[model samples]
Target chain A: GSSRPMKQTKESPNVGDVMSRDVVTVFEDIPVEKAAKLIISGSFDHLPVVSRDGRLIGIITAWDISKAVASGKPSRIAEIMTRRVHSVRLDEPIELAARTLDTHSISALPVVDREHKVIGMITSNHLSRLLARRR
Target chain B: GSSRPMKQTKESPNVGDVMSRDVVTVFEDIPVEKAAKLIISGSFDHLPVVSRDGRLIGIITAWDISKAVASGKPSRIAEIMTRRVHSVRLDEPIELAARTLDTHSISALPVVDREHKVIGMITSNHLSRLLARRR
Candidate 1:
């Protein structure tokens, strides 16, 4: 049950159409230091956290990596990742995805399929670019 | 001149009063890889770029670090850091600081004084927390 008002659109675009397909991801058990390196070197603020079987398990952000590093204690990505992640389905409307970003105060969401495998990602940057182009 | 509207307030709190005193920062001369490590480990999305004297010169973001890493080329924080940084004065109202963050599409701003040295930092997280507490 979504709390925000839905933006009505005829033949609304699905997330699969709007999401960035070249998704960047991180492993669950990697050292926090290495994960931080991947995230930093990759220039991504957030990365989809994946299990060994390539299933979406959690989500991690630069903020999460920083906390782990700041702690000065060894840690793993899984420990720092946000386990209760908000994700959008491939078939979901674009407006719903946008609403999800706003409601959660997050920049991006990993798009998943029925098997919960990440297929792509949608982010505020993409949404803003889309809006800008329309104007 | 700021492109965004300047938020007005009476008896406004200066940034120095509200900003985080323990700001996480990076040196301009540091390797991009190291900067990424600092950003990720610190759980901070942005870090003020400082000169050897600890004077603010530029700023870097997690996105910048990730890009540098993804580029797979040798780079320094100075090369990737945004030299044209948006900073707030220590005496400026907190609303102005908030507006700056909103207009810039950035998560945080480094607070500077007359010497352009970073004295503190303000971020969206702090603003949200402040609002949450007031409610």
Candidate 2:
């Protein structure tokens, strides 16, 4: 009895639609102190760690930098970066991104392309903005 | 005419309804190094800095810790804490909280009482979770 089309009702936005395109990444070989400076200088909390080929190899967060400072850990990003990085594809559903973040207890995820290169970044901040607009 | 009452249609949640009540606060005089440790040990990024009488004075965030480490700043919390803090009331609507966050470009807000004491905390994470549930 509804007038809305099925396509209109089922059009869920993909991660690419909401993810931030201006992603700032750090090289894995960079010093932790430098990484700390980069994170502190920016408004964001997470930075994707990249390889020489510009592929996302890991992630370093403000929490990781705090841990480094708190414990006086090693100097290089390789020593403190989370190597087991979780990411999503550009075409993935937003719900899947939300579930992935909830399951891993992370605030952000790197959106990779077919070549496994970082194309964008998505975070709970983006989701919050989406929700705010919905209202 | 619809049978639904106006109250039923207009019932909106407040900041107190969704904020995290188990807030962890730090005294203003505590060493910044200790606050860094506290933030590293917990899953939170922001800590409400309070006075001796437990009134919310300012906030120290992981970003602040990173800045301290990067710039080799002073040791005390009061020297580096964000003194001009923005807060929300318990009974305020969630839209107001969202607007405040958007306007200030801050991720979290401390939910305060009539005495200006922090009773709970709300962040973008809470808003993201609310959105996830709505889906």
C-alpha lDDT of candidate 1 relative to the true structure: 0.69
Each model's DockQ score:
0.11, 0.40
TM-score against native, each model: 0.55, 0.89
Best by lDDT: 2
Interface DockQ of candidate 1:
0.11
lDDT of candidate 1 over B6-106, digit per residue (tens): 22212345677777888877788787667767766565678899888888889988666544434443567778889989999988866677766656666
Structure candidate 1, residue pairs in collision: A40-B66, A41-B69, A41-B70, A42-B66, A43-B66, A43-B67, A66-B40, A66-B41, A66-B42, A66-B43
DockQ category of candidate 2 = acceptable
Tens-digit lDDT string for candidate 2 (B82-103) = 9899999999877778777767
lDDT of 1 at A128: 43
Q: Report interface Cα RMSD per prediction.
A: 10.2, 3.8
* Candidate 2 local Cα displacement, residue A12, angstroms: 4.0
